[model samples]
Target: MLDHCNGHPLAIIALGGVLATKKSLDEWESVCKNIQSHLQGDEESYSGVYDVLAMSYYDLHYNLRPCFLHMGHFPEDSRIDVEKLYNLWIADGIVSSTQDQIGKERSLEDIADDYMNQLVQKGMIQVNRKVSDGRISSCSLHDLMRDYCLEMTREENFLQIMYIDEQQNASADALTDKARRVTMYVGKEDGQSVLKSLSGKFSSLRSLMFISTSTEQDEDEDSCEWIRTLCRRFKLLRVLDFEGRVVLKGTFPSEVGNLIYLRYLCLKGTRITELPSSIRKLKSLLLLDLRVSRVIIKLPNVLSEISLCWLYFPVRILSQEYDNTQGYEIEDGSQLILNKLSHLERVSEVDLDKVDVKSLLERTSMRNLSATCRQKKESLVPFLKSSTIKHLSLKIDAGLLTGNSEMLLSKSSSLRILHIDAGSWPVTQLTIRVDMFPCNLVELGFWYCKLSEDPMPVLEKLPNLRNLQLHICYGGVEMNCSDTSFPELTYLELDGLFFLNFRNVKMGGFPKLLEMAIYNCPLQKIPDALHPGINILCSSILDPLANEYRLRGKASEEVQIPNLNTASEEDQMPKLCEFPLLVLAIIPFVMLSFYFCRSKKH
Candidate 1:
């Protein structure tokens, strides 16, 4: 039965069960034969059953293959880098177990090529063949295929509608009433008139994203007025991203506060300052990205009551200066704000630069805090001491916290991630002494600071340490005398350190070390006796023999060691000489002679 039709056995059985009541086996055979005979002249001609069978094969192959599974990491609407996707699949254990044999039999690159061709033919993926690199650099799925993938995977319904330059015909009116998330990308040619026309149509939308790809032009009142009208209409929107090319000239309208359901608001790269005092009414906002907005106004004092987890404000100066003379009115207001947000939790990540610490501290409990400080160190000291911030990044001068720096370091107990950029500090005689280091520290980065002393003692104290990055720092020359170790360290990166010496360094300390990257460092050689259980990857081959020995597992306990002197001599000799010499030097000379004489007699 299977030989009669060129169909997969599983697909054939499933389809046979579905069509069993309609016809007998002989009847099905007759229909399949008709399909085959019809395709004698026209290759594309096939029966309905044959079409269904082919579609089943395509769906099964796309869902089960590693190449297609890896494409799921990219956003549905975005183009993906094929090379990067393949590398990630290799790392994630998605490739076949017999990958080495497959590579030798039919090239690993060709396997990817064939799979991409099959997917494209099946209409499950679209390929852009016009790239200059002669490789399929980018690929995306059609909307119908994407919808099917989403339904089969049961992925979380995060985004619903995405209109990227589809013609706004009468068919789009069907989307007006559905209770789904929506994203609309507008090109430069889509003017205010188009937006005004559709403003009344999106009454039930959960999200509206407007991406303007417009070149800079003279700002007019009509453009700004249209934006204001759109904001007023979408009062129930949960997320809004009106970025790029749009001019925001007038003061923020107080009517924007009516959007009480707004959770995420991004107004990046706009020329606007001073949010309306009514912004304090947006109590449900979770994230606000206003970076490069050049807004120089003091934040609303009521900002402390909002439940924001991520906030990015990279501008330099805020409008209101911190003053202590305001007495109980200011103090009570701040206390009420903090007490209301005491239950606020930290987000996964955050990035801010050159902001006032007082304004930020009152708003959120940040898990990742990346910001520069404009206030004095003393002003930031209290906020650092109060919160259990996991990640703390600061770009400041070393002179600010010189005399009494212990107070700042001791309070950061919950800090697992720390990034310090000490600009323009002298490296010749620098010392940092903390009473107790962050015990839960997992990742640490240092930039433009000189240590002169070894940081091994400080690093070893962090039992959960995983990653350490030192950039443009002059501190690797010193070595600690104690037997301190980083047992859980996995990644270590050193960049632009001119005086680094690791000759006497041992590698057994880092049992879980997987990667080490060093660039622009003056190291003569890497240590020879690293753990045989792990792979060592370096940019250049300082010692080829050692690398080969590691790759072949010669140093492992399972392999017996030969005579060191004889092995060294043999390894150094020419490869052609070694092969013949090995065959000539047998275990017993008499046995070889007897074998040759017996063969001659026969």
Candidate 2:
């Protein structure tokens, strides 16, 4: 059956999809002959793929067309955020919530999510990133799928994307009355000219996105001028995304309030330290994304101007970032954050210092809450007591997290999803008892903690946990599992366990564990046993073994095999030359072995 069709994967898959319905041999051969004859003339890979993709595209539910096509507006291979994308789809009037007489309802967001899953299953898109709770946070299209999107978008007059990298700038000849939305992906400095010349050129333009092509060294000297120029020309824009750029000299331009029709404003990567008061004028705005950008720092204290006093000061501040290689001090911003940010909604995503957690609890009723707890607020019992908050993402401070501070998460009857991120804190080695965590947590993400102690004992007590991730716990000793651990955990991931000892785990420890991953960890091999149901995905197991070989002076040593080779073990250089590699690899293992030996002795 496979011999009749060309070896093209898409062609084979498409033929298989068609052939699955055929019950009789005659029906199968007749359909097979038709496919084989069709392949006789058009042998190009694109043709085969086009037919397969087209067939699958038409097979989609009618309501999914616009949502699927809308994704083409994003830059090729772009990491499209699911929340942002679905919100855009909703705002674009592409999909809406629906309920039948049977009382089953599907929200607009849910519909978009289902469409995304459909596309993913059909191999139209790939998951690029997942959030702490294992939801598809971001996804990207394949090169072929992206190309198809471009072709379909142009043909349908949906969205016109202009690239600054291409010669002659694709927008020069492409702008027309039909182009309702324009996305300028900046890759070169000449993007200024492209925008300057193209202002007011498209009367139908309702959405304009200026995405930075590169995050490195993007110094937009005339970004203010660009904003001024854009506002002057495009007055009808519903979505103005000047995000991921250093906007208006570290200040949000006050004129942003003038865009009364604007619905979404994303300023995630901007250098803006203070939001101008005029922002409150955005009455039509539904989402105001102001997430701080994540930058790697050699010295965490360098951003002390902002991060310091994380406990009490108003988060909003008028300040410059750490400019010099040697860091600089910041002016005290005690009054800057409190007085400036006056428009705090009841249930909003804001800086920890922006609004008091108490103030938020009093003002409104909310189902989801995200709050930051500085070292000062380590006693999380107050926030956990809030009965309204079911989904909570709490940011933790890393400085010596051991005090009288205890997080009895199980006691929080409301909290189902608890995301704990110890941002930029070094956990050289910290012991956390099982009593400190919430027992009823359905999802727990202990990321960036650099824990040095075994977490299995601490986590396995959570009977209701479905998804658990222990990421970047660098100085960990071992991941030991007892017999009655993880009774209901479905997904378990242990990442960045750089110095793991890879010790004890019973075969039936995680009886209900559906998926398990141990990545970027120094584990030579899986434990000798595992539950029959657990999919223990321990990739990069070779890295530790490679280190082990380097330890025995066998990494690059010439072996004494009785075969035709250049040199034998004794014929090589002296032991002194191998000293560095020996210490680099073997000394640690020796210490680990000694520790185990001593442990057994004890």
lDDT of 2 by residue, 107-163 (tens): 444566677876676666678766444568899877766766676677678787766
Task: Give the TM-score of each candidate.
Answer: 0.51, 0.66
The number of the candidate with the highest TM-score is: 2
The lowest-lDDT stretch of 10 consecutive residues in candidate 1 is: 322-331
Query: Model 1 lDDT vs. the true structure?
Result: 0.48
lDDT value for model 2: 0.55
Residue-wise C-alpha lDDT for candidate 1, range 1-602, written one tens digit per residue: 34423454433543453344335877666545543432211223323334434333333453234455445434567676564444333323343223454473332234555666655554446674322213476788544345444433323333344343435422232343443345454444344644654555657665655545345563553235565676677788776655543555445566768788877676655554445667677887765655434434334446556665445553332112322111112212232233345424332222232223455466444444544442366754654565645455444444445656546655675555555555431322345553434556667776655554566666655677777787655535644322346777777776655555655545456666665665545454544333443433333122233333434555222332221111243443435634665345333333423443353366
* Per-model CA lDDT versus the true structure: 0.48, 0.55
TM-score of 1: 0.51
